[model samples]
Target: MYWPNCGKGYLGPGGLDNYGKYFNCTGGVAGYIDRAVFGNHMYKHPPCQKLYENKVYYDPEGILGTLTSILMVYLGVQAGRILNTYVNVRDKVIRWTTWGVVTGLLGGALCTFSRDNGPIPLNKQLWSLSFVLVTSGMAFVVQAFLFMIVDILRKWGGRPFFYPGMNPIILYVGHEIMRDTFPFAWKPTTETHATYLFMNLWGTFLWVAFSIFLYKRNLFLTI
Candidate 1:
C-alpha cells in the first residue's frame, strides 16, 4: 500500500491531467483506504470496477496478486491430482466438467452481469478471486476438451501446441525478451486494428516456428 511507485504516471481521482495525485498517498489515511479498496495503478488501465467508484486500480505484482497466485497454483495442483486419480477418460472428463462448471458459476456469482463493475470484479492485475476461479474453471474445461479429443477420440495430434508445450519456459522467456523487437512488434505506419492484429498473429507464428525448431532438435527446457 505504501509503494512509492505503485500508481506513478497514471491519472488519479483529481481527473485526467492530475497524474498520481488522487489521494494523499505517501502513508495518508485516504491513500490507505483507496489502496485497500482498489489495488495500485489507476483508472486508465483495466479490468476496472465501475460500480463503487469505477476508479479501482490494478497491481499485477502486489500483495493481492501473490495471494491469488498461490490459490491458482493450488487449483492447478488439484486439477493434476484429479487427472492422476481417474484412469477412465470418461470419468476424467465428467469430473473436470463438473469442477469447471461449479467453479465457474461460483466465480460468476461473485460479480454482476457487467464486466467492469460488481461486488467483486474479475480484475487480473489485482488477482481478484473471481478472475482466479473463472480462469481456472476455463482451464479445467479446456483440459477436458483436449484430453477427450487427443487421448480418447484420437482425432487431432496437438501439433504446434505439442512442440511449444514441451518447452513452455523457453517460449515464454523468448517471447518476453523479443516482444518489442523487430518482426514481433513495430511502430505501425497506420494505427489500425488490422495492422495490430497482423503483428500479433505474426509474432505468435514466429513463436510456433521457434518451438518447432526446438522440438526437431530434441531441445527442451524444464524445471
Candidate 2:
C-alpha cells in the first residue's frame, strides 16, 4: 500500500488508510482480514507523524513489510533449488539463464503496466509487489550472468567482488563509520558534482585495495 497523499507535507492519512483502500480494491478476503486487524489498530496507533514529515524515506508498512521480504527470500531459495538440482551442467545453465531473462522481462512489463494503469505505482518505499518482481528479476539475471562467466566460461571471475562479499558486514560498517571522515570525505575547492564523484571513486578504490590486501592474507570476517 502506497500513500501518495502523505509524506513531507501530509500526515494522519496513515498506512492503514492507504493499504485498506488497496486491500478493498485488490486484497479480497485477505484484505478484509488486514483491514479488520490493521485498520482498527490504525485508529489507536497512527503512524509517526514527525517521522513522515522529516524523514526523506518513510514507509508506513514498517515491520509488516517483512512479509513481502520473506517472499523475496523464498524466490531466492527457489532459484537456489533450481541450481542445486541434479541436472546436466549445460541444461542447468540454460534453465537458470532462461528463467532469469523471462522473469526480468515479465517484471519489467508488470512495472510498466502498473505505472500506467493502477491506484498504485511501482515504488521502492512501499516495496510494492512490482518492485519486488523487478528487483528479483534483475538479481536472477545478474546471478546467471556471473555464473555463466565464472562457472561456465572460466575465462573471468568475481575476484574483485569476492573480497568485498567475504566481509560485507565489516565493509558496510566501516564505510558507515568513516563516511564523514577524511579520505572518504574532503572539502573540495570547486565543490562540483564531479568532485564528489571523484572523491567517492577514490574512496571505493581504496576500499577495494584494502579488501584485496586482506584477501591476500587469507583474512575474512563473517557473522
Candidate 3:
C-alpha cells in the first residue's frame, strides 16, 4: 500500500512516472512497508493486504519517514562537504571514512526497528533517506582512503581519474574476486551486487584513484 504523494517521477518504481527515467527505484526501499514492494510479488503481509483497498495506501502516521529522509540527506551532504573541503589527505580521508561507516550503522539500525504496517509503518521517505545516508556515508569513507592511496602513489599524473567506474576492471574483475574468493558470498549476478549495500563500498574503491588525482591537481568532474 505505498501510495506516493510525490507526483511525476517520484511516484514509485515501475510506475508510469519513472519507466524510462535514468533513476531506477527497486522493488524494495528502506523503511517502506512490504506492501510497497512485495505487494506486486508473493510476499506474505496480512497487514498490507488488509490495507491495500483503503483510499490512502500508506500509514496515516508515516510522515516521519519523509522527515527522516530530509535529515539524512542534509547530514550526508554536509558530511561530504566537510571531507571534500579538506586539503590534507589524512584529515579528508579519516573524516569521510568515519561518516560512511557511521551512517551505514544508522541505516542498519533503522532496518531493525522497521515493521511492515505494524504499530510502526515504513514509507518511501525512509527508504530514500536510508539510501542517501548509506551512499553518502560510504562515499566519504572511500574518498578518504582513495585520497590517501593516491597521495602515497604518485602515478596518477598529480590529478584525479574519475571515469570508467563500472568498467570491466571493476564489474568483471573485482566482482569475480568477491564471488570466487569470499565464502558464501552473496555476489550480484546481474545487478550491482547481491549485497546491494556494498554498492558504495565498491564504488569508492573504483573511483578514489581518480578523485585523488583531481584533488592533487585541482581538477574536478563537473557537469
Candidate 4:
C-alpha cells in the first residue's frame, strides 16, 4: 500500500525525496533528514481529502521496511549456511549460483513495467517482493563469485571490501555523518553527469580509505 506520489511530487524512485519541488528528483541531505525524521512529505494532490492522504503512506522507515530488511538478512544467513555446510567449494558455488538464477528469473517474471502502478515494480522505498528477490539474487551471485575467487583461488585480498564488511555499522554511520562535509562531498564546479559521478565515487573511496585505516589499526565497531 503506497501512494503514487507523496505530496507535490515529494517522493521519487530509488529512495529519493523530491524536496517539495521536482528539480531532478534529487533530495538534499537536509531534506532527507527532515523527511526521514519529521515526515514532512509533500504530495502532488491538494490538501483536505481522504484521511489516508494526510498519513505517511509511503513510509520506508516503518515496520514494513524492517520486515523487508529482515527478509534480506534471512537470505544472507542462508548464504552463510551454504558456506558452513559445504566442505566442497564446488558444491557451495553451485548451490549459490543455482539459487541466484532461480530467484533472479522469478523476480524478473513477476515485474511488470508497462504502467507506473503495475504489478511489483522494483521499488526500494516500498521494498516490494520483486525488489527483494532481485537484490537477493544479485547478492547471492556476487557472493558466490567472490567466494570462489577469494576463498578457492586465493586471487584477491579483499582489502577495502572486507574492511568495510567487518565494520559495516560504523562505516555506514561515519559515512552518513560526513556525507555533506568537505573532502567527502562538495558543490561541483560543473553540474554534468560526469562531475556528479566522480564526486560520488570519490566520496565512496574516502569511506573505503577510512575503513582500511581502521582495519590497519585493528579497530572495529560492533554492537
Best by lDDT: 1
Q: Quote each prediction's TM-score.
A: 0.68, 0.61, 0.36, 0.64
Deviation in angstroms for 144 in model 2?
1.8
lDDT of each: 0.68, 0.59, 0.46, 0.65
Q: Name the candidate, 1 or 3, with the larger lDDT value.
A: 1
Prediction 2 TM-score vs. true: 0.61
Candidates 1 and 2 compared: the better one by TM-score is: 1
Q: For model 1, which pairs clash?
A: none
Window of ten residues with lowest summed lDDT in model 3: 46-55
Q: lDDT tens digits, residues 1-223, model 3? A: 3434432323233222233341223222322444454444433332222312212234322344456667766876776687568777667666777777888666545444353322222334334454555555666676666666666665454333444332335444445555434432434554432345475455546455534444567554432
Cα distance off (Å), candidate 3, residue 201: 17
* Cα-lDDT of candidate 4: 0.65
Over the stretch 159-221, how does candidate 1's per-residue lDDT look in tens digits? 868888998999899989988899888877875657778989999999999999999999999
83-147, model 4: which lDDT tens digit per residue?
89989988999999998998887677667532233355565655656778888999899999899
In model 2, which regions exceed 4 Å deviation?
A: 1-64, 113-120, 185-204
Query: Once all C-alphas are superposed, what RMSD does model 2 give against the true structure?
Result: 8.1
Count of clashes in candidate 4: 6
